[model samples]
Each structure stands twice: as structure tokens, then as C-alpha cells.
Target: MLGHQLLWPVVAIVVMLVIDVIAVPSFLDLRVQDGHLYGNPVDIVRNSAPVMLVALGMTLVIATRGIDLSVGAVAAIAAAVACTRIVESADEGAASAAILACTTALAACVLLGVWNGFLVSVVGIQPIIATLVLMVAGRGLAMLVTDGQITTPSNDAFSGLATGFVLGLPIAFLIALGMVVLTAVLTRRTALGMLIEAVGINPDASRLAGVRARTITWTVYVFAAVCAGMAGLIIAANTNSVNANSLGLWIELDAILAVVIGGTALTGGRFSLAGTVVGALLISTLVRTIPSIGIPSEANYLFKAFVVILVCLLQSPRARAALRVRGRRAASSKAVAA
Candidate 1:
């Protein structure tokens, strides 16, 4: 059942790779230097780490019939807070400073998540509207935290999160992989996954069935926020800097797209973690392939949009049925002519 759910995305990613190989002869080339791997595939995964992390959380939120528009803002705020904390630390160069900065950023995200959860589950505001409030104001909040300035904090330990490698793989990718694994274990090995699905499928029914719907909903929101916070840290660490206005800008869209492409229905209920991972990889590969194939950078979004639409259509049962009907009609016409 899992394999069937994931087939489309897995096939899509493999197709993208084949395209990459055709467009760039060296696309598959990999080498080891100084105990670290280097290659386009590695780079694609490394660059995708942040989006992958954000998408992991988005998967759960979407599974619960909730959308978190504020994730990008929350991520920006996390990066801003972390960078500002590092700059303000008495010893910004120390590893301890990095630890403190990370802790502070994630803690702030928790509060933001709680705020979102309260508005949606407690206040009874629609999920979209509740998150939109934060989406619009969270960046301003981030700006205020950074004193309306870009923060570039020099911290080797902090930068290592993005730039460093472990066991011949990028640290950032490893971190994302770990999160995916952890989330899978939590959701699959326990009752949490079923509870989440129950709430998403029908909140009132789940509540009557002895499931804590509100709590489950609230928990997923908080987890989503923390995941965004971690993604923020990775993005900021990549450059050792944070720009309140631009950090994590529009990333929510990418995460949402990834979830959709991963075979997760927008209406909620069933979700595939493995499919989400492949979807993220496919998006990242498309981004890389566009430039490699010499498509103008300005029209990148156009190409991506086209591909996304095509994938969604392909995923639709009605669309597939339409295609099959057309094919049969054409065959009948040919047989009549003969």
C-alpha cells in the first residue's frame, strides 16, 4: 500500500534525474575529497535540506486538514532571532553561543506556534485565517527583533550546521534525514499517526470517539512551527547572516507544493512521508535542471508552475480517466478507418 502511494513521486524524481543526466553529462559525477562527498546529487540534496525540513512538518499539518501560512514568517523570525542572539552574545565566537542562539530561536518559535494553535483550536478561527494573521505580521515582528537591520554574525560553530559535513554527507541533509526518520517513527510506531488521521478525517467524529481532536491539532501546529524554526536555522547558518525581509520568503509555498506533490490530498487524512521526501527532491532537481538546461532565470517560476500543474493533473483520477477515454476513442476511430 505504501509503495503504491509513493509510486508517482518516485517515478517523477527518477524521470527528473534522467533528464538531468541527459542535459548535463557530469550530473551524476561524484567524488570524495577530505572525507566528504562532492557531486550535483549531493549538492541538490544539500540545497534542499531546509525545504525538506519545512515540508516534513507541513506534511503533518496538511494531514490534519490544516494549512500553516505563517511558516515562512516563523522561519524568518527564527533566523533573525538566532542571528541577533549570536551577535549579542558576549562571546559570539564560542560554540556555546551557537547553542544559545539555536535554543533561543526555537523557543520563540514554540511561542509563535502556541499562538497559532490557540487562535485555530481554541478561538475557533479558521486555520487559514489564523495563520494568515501571523504570516502578515510575523515578518514585522522579526524586523523589530533585528532592530530593522540585517544581521551577519560570525560564528564558526553555527555556520558548520550548513557548511560542514559528517561521514561524507552534508550535515544539513543529515539533519533533515534525521527529522524525517524521527517524524516517521513517532507517527507510525505509535498511535499518534492514527489519531492525527482521525482528527483530519472528521474532527467531531474523532472527538466523540474519545480522541482529543483539539490537542492533536494543537500539537501538529507546534511541531510544524519548530520544524520551520529548524529550517530557519539551517538557512541562516548557510550564510552566517539573516535578512528579516528576505529570509525564508515564500518558502511556505514550496513546502505546500512539496506536500501536495507527495500524494497527500489537500482535503487531508492519508499522507505519505516517503512520498513527501521524493517530492521535495523532485522540486529541488527541477530547480537545478532548469538552469542546467539554460532556461532563463527570470522564467524559472513559470517552468516550475507548469510542471506542478502537470503533476497534479496526472495525479487526478478524473484527468486520467479523461485521457483513457480519449485514447480509446482514437483507437476506435482508427479501427473503423481500417
Candidate 2:
């Protein structure tokens, strides 16, 4: 069962990798320079780190049959807040200022998460509608923080959060991997996973059974926000600047696609962090592969949409069954002719 669930995403990733290699023969090449890893594969993972982090939290939120449309906006807001602080600091290079800026941005994200939780769990707003509120307003808030301008801060310590390397691997990738592992351990190692699934499967039943559905729902939103915030920090560090409007644009869509491709049902129930990671990597690879494969800029999105649809269809049970029936029929006809 597990293998079947993972089959399509794995296949998609392999197919994409093959395509990438075909398009750019050096796509698979890897080497060490100054004790740091460098390659297309490494770049894919490094670039995908932000989306992977967001998808990790999105996995839990989706497990509760909820969605966070505001993750991108929240990420932008985090970047805005952090960069603004760093830029406005008397000593931009000060480690203390960088730390304080990051800390403040993360704290704000937590509060934003709490707001989403309150709307969904306490006020009984639809998750989509509740998060949508922020999706629209959060960017404006981000712009406000940046004074409606792109804020660039020159701080080596802050930039290192994304660009620095540890043990020859990208620090961003390491941070994302750590978050994935921690999330898996927290959810699966405790009773939390089961309770979350129960609530997702049947909130009323879970409530009746003494599983605090509201609390689980609320917690997931907060976690999602924090994850987005972390991703925002990495993104800001990557560019050493924050463009409030475009910083996290469309990232929410990528995160959702990652969650969907990871084999988690939108209807909610069980979830897999490993699968989500693969999905994120797949999306990241596709983003890089499209241009390298000679797809026109104008038609890029169309090509991507077609590939996504094909993958989703391949993963569908009915589609698989239909294909199997056709294969069996073809085999029978061949045998009879022989």
C-alpha cells in the first residue's frame, strides 16, 4: 500500500531527472570546490529548501483538511519585517541586530498564525476563507513594513543563514532537512499524529471521543505560519533584500502542489513527510528543467500544467485500473493472434 502511494511521485521525479539530464548533459554532474558541493542536483535541493519547509507545515495543515493560502503572504511579511529591522538598525553588521531582527519577524509570524487559528478553530470560519483574509492583507502589511519599497540590508550574518555552507552542504538545505525530521518526530513519535488524523477524518467524532479537534487544528495553522516565516528568512538572506510584493509570490501554490503530489488527499487523513519532501524536490526540478529543455517562456506554464495533469492522472486509481484493463486486453488479443 505504501509503495503504491509513493509510486507516482517517485516516477515523476525520476522522469524529470531523466529529462533534465537529456536537456543538459551536465545536469547530473557533481563536484567539490573549496570543500563545498556544487551540482545541478545540489542546486535543486538547495533551491527547493524554502518550498520544502512550507510544504512540511502544509502537510500537517492539509492532514487536518485545512489549507493555508496566506503562507506566501506571511513569508513576504516575515522578510519585510526582518529586512526592515536590519536596514534600520544602527549597526547593520551587528550579530545582535540580525538575531533580534530574525527573532522579531518569527514572533510576528507566530501571532499571524494564531490569528489564522482563531478564525478557523474558534470563529468557525472556513479554512480557505479564513486564510484568504490574510492572503490579501498580508502583502499590504508587508509593504507597509518596507515602507512600500524594497528593503535591502547588508549584513553578513543574516545573509549566511541562506548562503552559508556547513560540512560542504548548503545551510538552507540543512535547516529544511532538520525541520522535516523534527516535524516527523513530533507528529509520528507522539500521540499527535493519530489524534490529528482522527480530527481530520471526523472532527465531530474526534470531539466526542475527547480528542481536542480545535486545538489540533489551531496548532497546525501556527506551525504552518512558523514554517513560512522560516522560509521567508532564508529567502531574504538569499537576496540580502526583501521585495514585499514579489518575495513569496505564488509560493503558496507550489507548496499546495507539493502537498498534493506527496499523496496526501485534499480530503485529509494520513500524511507523509517523506513524500512531501519528494514532491517539493520534484517541483523544484521541474522549475529548473522547463527552461533548460527549450520550452518557450510564454508556454512554460502551459507545459508545466500539462505535466502536472499527467502525473496526477497517473496517480489516480481509476486511471491506473483503466490502463491495466487495456493492457490485459491488448495482451489477450496478441496471444490469440499468435
Best by lDDT: 2
**Residue-level lDDT tens digits of model 2 in 305-335:** 7877887888888888899899999999999
To one decimal, what is the Cα RMSD in angstroms of model 1 from the true structure? 1.9
CA RMSD of all predictions: 1.9, 1.3
Predicted candidate 1 versus true structure: per-residue lDDT over 1-338, tens digit per residue: 32354666667778878988888988999999999999999999998888899899899999989999999999999999999999999999999999999999999999999999999889999999999999999999999999999899999999999989998999999999999999999999999999999988998999999999899999999999999999999999999999989999999999999999888888989888887887788788888889988899999999999888887777777877798899999999999999
Itemize residue pairs with steric clashes in candidate 1: none
Candidate 1, poorest ten consecutive residues by summed lDDT:
1-10
lDDT per prediction?
A: 0.91, 0.92
Error of 1 at 187 (Å): 0.8
CA lDDT, candidate 1, residue 288: 87
Against the true structure, candidate 2 reaches a TM-score of 0.97
